[model samples]
Target: MNGFTRTVMRTVLQAIPTILGIIVISFLLLYLMPGDAVDAIAGMSGSASQETMDALRDTYGLNDSFIVQFFRYLGGVLTLNFGTSISYSAPVLDVIMERLPSTMILMLTAFVIALTVGIMVGWAMAVFAGKWPDRLLTSTSLLLYSAPNFWVGLMIIVIFSARLQWFPSGGAETIGAALTGWGWFLDRLKHLVLPSCALAAFFVAIYARLTRAAMLEVLRQDYIRTAAAKGLHPMLIQFRHGLRNALIPVTTVAGMHLGNMLGGAVVVETVFNWPGIGRLTMSAIAARDTQVLLGILLLTSVVVIIVNVIIDWLTTLLDPRIRS
Candidate 1:
């Protein structure tokens, strides 16, 4: 097989141990927590009899020894069976699947917005280095980077939703809108705008700063000087050579941010009341739904590992030096 193929295979193989470690650690930690699924359910019932609680513990195998329970869980995970949610009375995977699409839409939209805006702004800063434009961009990015996402979200909601009434304050759609076609599309987009902006705000700042730094570093390289001396058009040199090289670091950060967002924009999702995995995860934690919580953690770990692998592959593709 080719070197790249081998590299990819090796990376995938390496990730198995990491995944197993996550499972073991998360299982043990959760297992050692104060209460089990039975307590959570019995608490909700308010007056559940000891016999009822005992039956539940026995039925769900919560009464098993810790090692037996963990191994049983590990075996289920190996077969793609994430078990059932104690609170939801549904398979963990099924519950996650139902909410996954909304989260994906929000995260992908935010990622595109952050990447595009950050790159453009950062490139502008590089082009106007040491000038008023650069100073302004730098200051703005720092301010944004320092601000909390939830606060930004609330501020936007106040101005746009509460004051101007331009968009809904929260939710993925209108409660009972029967619209279709472009109308439905527009409605969804409107609902998405606020949350997307809030979620992307901090990431946009991070990308902008990283890209600007990368670009500045790249611009000082010997090859950049050679390209400039060769009489290539300045714009072409910047875009074709400088920007492409600068993107190496930017791409890595972008992949990490994408993975983080995929794991769920918990704060932003909670603030917006969006019915996504993040919100679901919060509910699971509050209810102590062990199966759902474990399922989310496993899914998140897998997503992060996959994203990192993709970033590594892309980096090698972008800079052949990495292949060696």
Candidate 2:
């Protein structure tokens, strides 16, 4: 009925083909890999009879023709009836959902910290361009961007966790802590500190650099000079005017990355043993659980579409010129 509704509908409709493309490509790639879930199961079991493997494939419909399997899987995806995961012997959807909350929490904490701190630091860099502060921040961001995330995570754990004993070494929570209420939330927060930092580090570098460039470019514009000529407070002029407009590029990159957020967390999740979707995805990959892998891919594409829609709405809200 309204413009935003219309935009959302149009976007969803347009995304249908994209989602289909992702599904087709991922399915073909995974299914075409050297082995299927049957082989993984057999290998893990030490060995299996030829007939046993055949029957297992048949049970999972893995012996179907490629076209048949593709359509069958696609149909289930469309209907939200994602097939069972071989590794877990459970519905793929249910299994992913079980681990989704932890990933979501980790992602939310990392994203918020990255965007907020990145923008603030970027603003500072722009304000102090060519100075010691700018050089320092730039060097720090470059360090974060260059370092391997898993390595960063390991170092953080060694110092803060293993040595200092400030937080648990790794995990979503204390095993059998039986915490609840604020205590429960606090414990979760403590566990989150290391992983979130590791996950956010790369993104923070990216956003900070992007924001710095965009802000610097924006501040050079005529309007910024005009605002300065009006004798506005330096901080207000730098942040309120320069930073807001500069957010376009930062927001664009952030939205583009929301889709891959879960995937990127795999390294951090693995390092921290966080029991999230990323860890589950790693297990699925190791086991070659095509059904679970496909389910995760499909969900990721859906998340991309949904996040883009939200980002579009927010962008238009932030910059009213886009609404027209």
Candidate 3:
């Protein structure tokens, strides 16, 4: 009934079309991709009789007309039945659910690190504008932004894992460690550090730059000058007034980056051999597991839409003028 509630409801309603479009486009693209899933399966087994291939195609409904098959898949998706994976012999949803936790952990850890460090460094840059500190921070952030995540991941592995033996080279946890309680928690944290750093590197640069720019612009606003004239503590003016307004742009960027990371931490996950959805997606693509691929795409699309909606709501909350 309230304005905010109506806004949230309207946003959700709007997202339905986007979700449908994602499904339609992803399905059509994958459907139009060359080579049949049956053929890929057969080839994996080093050639099969023509009859066997034919039977396989028929068994998987690959022999159906394109429209018929597409509608059937769409109907299943509407019913929360993503079908079984051709390669894994498991339900697509189940397979994705199993891997989802690992990916969420990695992405969330990376997000927190990026947001915290980026905000702090950016705030520092704003505070020290036109000085050596600002110049150094700006240059460092640019370098981080330009560096590739996979390369950063590999270098971290080399230094921390191979050279220093400080952390496991790759994986969610040690293969056979009998860790429990705090021990298990610590092990997971250790395995998480390098990948998180690698994944967060580029995002840190992006957030830092955006935040610094936002802060600079915000600091020049009339209200900021008024606050300064009112004899409020300098730090209070910066943190309470300036930072609040600056966060609007940062929130938008953070939401977009979070959505992207959810869809795929492909490079970082692959480099670190983290058993996340991104690695699973790579395997599914390599094997031409259409069902699994579609499932991942759908899940990712949903996450992205949800994240953006939340960001919109947050923005409205932060700056009431956006509700207009």
Candidate 1 ranges with C-alpha deviation above 4 Å = 262-264
Where does candidate 1 clash, by residue pair? none
Q: Candidate 3 at 318: error in angstroms?
A: 2.1
For candidate 2, write residues 173-258 as lDDT tens digits.
88888998999989988999999998998899999999999999999999999999999998899878999999988888898888
lDDT of 1 by residue, 215-316 (tens): 999999999999999999999999999998998999888987776665438889999999998999889887878889889888877777776777888888
Q: Please provide, for model 3 over 1-324, each residue's C-alpha lDDT reduced to its tens digit, 9 standing for 90 to 100.
A: 866777778878998898788888988898898887777877789989999988988899988888988899999988999999988999999999999899888988998999999998999999999999999999999998888887888889999999999998899988888899999999999999999999998888888888899999999999999999999999999999999899999988798887666643888889989999999999988888888999998898777777777787888888878877
lDDT of 1 at 278: 90
lDDT of each: 0.88, 0.89, 0.88
* Global lDDT of model 3: 0.88
The residue pairs found clashing in candidate 2 are: none
Per-candidate TM equals 0.94, 0.97, 0.95
Models sorted by TM-score, best on top: 2, 3, 1
